[model samples]
Target chain A: MMTTVKQAEKFAAKTLTEDGLIDFFSGIGLIAIGYFWLIDNSALSAIMPLAIVNFWKISRKRISEPRIGKVTLARGKKGNVRAGRTILIIVSLTLAVGVILWLKGGAGDVQGTWYYPLFAAGPSLFIATITFFSAIYLKCPRFFGYAGWIIAAAGITIWLGEGPARALMISGVPFLVVGLWTFAKFLSAHPKADQ
Target chain B: MALKPEALDKVIHEPARLLIMTHLYVVTDADFVYLKRATGMTAGNLSTHLTKLEGAGFVKITKSFQGKKPKTTCKLTAKGRKAFEEYRKNILEVLKT
Candidate 1:
């Protein structure tokens, strides 16, 4: 009985990814970043992740929930999520402070130049970290696969001296392909439920 | 000790309703579509079980509109939660005996 209950809860949690919208949006975000980077638009690339977060939320309400329904898991299950968010906040603030200090320490106006190495390897590593915790928090192992692919892409790009754009585009392809296929399959399997 | 067969809450003893309560027990709330899928009940079957649970005051069902479409959400009421806990304890004791 206990095991069955746990299984039911797990099934509910699994709904987060079953529709494949997150992967789909994540792919679009990364590809957008790649395109934005290629065109020398750092600001737009930077905002892609945030934009995709909103898109994912909206898409879930519009697309996924209508089909599979909405199940908001218990708050007690979000301990890991709280920890993840705390760590993210700390890391982001630390990086912000470090950048400020770097500028103050006579590294003036080095937005794109002094940070070249960071740029080349940072997005992949950062996203890898985020997706890693996201996997744990969301109870979705596929995110671990995403994290691994991102890190591998980062390593390859850094070793080959390839730009971030190419690595991002490469990393985004699998998610896009998988997400599209999964979403299509999900739609077919779970049509809009009767109200 | 004699087994207290009467200790089990009859309202939740039904397998389908048991599954529904367990699912709602773990979550704050869930929609009709979600519950239907989680319980693998046919639309009419799930609706029947949910109505029974709702009538027993063990579950609260709210019908509202999400846009033009109808949406039904269910949550375990306080009475429902306590009854579920009580039911679990009784079942555990029975198993122990």
Candidate 2:
């Protein structure tokens, strides 16, 4: 047997926990968005379903049906907070900052210099937090962690700096691409256990 | 005892796989990607070990499409469950000597 195979199997075995499932589902959401753009043609529309997928994936995995049913990731003592907390935190901060910026600037136009940057902050912080948490959750850094950090950086850049929409578009594309690629790789490598 | 036994033993004896099986033995399904990351293995590596386990009839590998991508799940089989239990006892019995 290939030693790498043994290593991969060992890794898979450890990830068989509830927190692991959530991470995997978050990955699913990221990958689904890639395809969603193809089907819906609107990245905005894709976000909703992507959110929905995150919700659905967790719920689906959490409800365990006995015998040929879904299994739960192990939870001992306090369970690791999945992306849910991270998502909530990012959304909250984005809104808080958006509100603060809006109040400071006074709303002449909602989409002006203020809100676009605010919007960028949400995803930027989200990707960053996820990158941090999941990397920590895995007990080390992964290639995905690096990619996610880059996405987070682009998002932060879009938030802090003033630029043409084209700049946002340019940076956003690579961030999204790298995020999707990591998710796709994760999905392709997932093992199927025949019951 | 069996050619596959050594492979199964490798999985079973490993602290991580044993821990994984301890969880999976109760659950019906688990995502392989999650498993691999948790176990700290590479993509090609995990698949190979899975193939070995599946070949031994110690575990079941089910491949399905979750949207366009393949979602591979793993579950312990009746045979696998039985074999591991026996294997565990055998190990314990030997240790007692």
Every model: Cα RMSD to truth: 3.3, 11.1
Cα error, residue B2 of model 1, in Å, equals: 6.0
lDDT of 1 by residue, A27-60 (tens): 9999899899889899999898899999999999
For model 2, how does the per-residue alpha-carbon lDDT over A1-195 read when each residue is reduced to its tens digit?
A: 223333533343334332233444444444454344435445663475467566756554433211123434333213457454756576677757875776677644445563666544454455555556545444444535544754655555565563223232333454345445644554455433332
lDDT of 1 by residue, B13-90 (tens): 888899999999988899999988888889899999999999999999999998898889999999999999999888
* Candidate 2 deviant stretches above 4 angstroms: A1-10, A13-72, A75-91, A109-122, A138-140, A143-152, A155-160, A163-195, B1-20, B23-97
TM-score, model 1 to reference = 0.83
TM-score of chain A of 1: 0.79
lDDT of each: 0.84, 0.52
**Best of the candidates, lDDT:** 1
Q: Which lDDT tens digits does candidate 2 get at residues B23-90? A: 45644457675555445566676777677777877778889875565667888889878767776676
TM-score of each: 0.83, 0.40
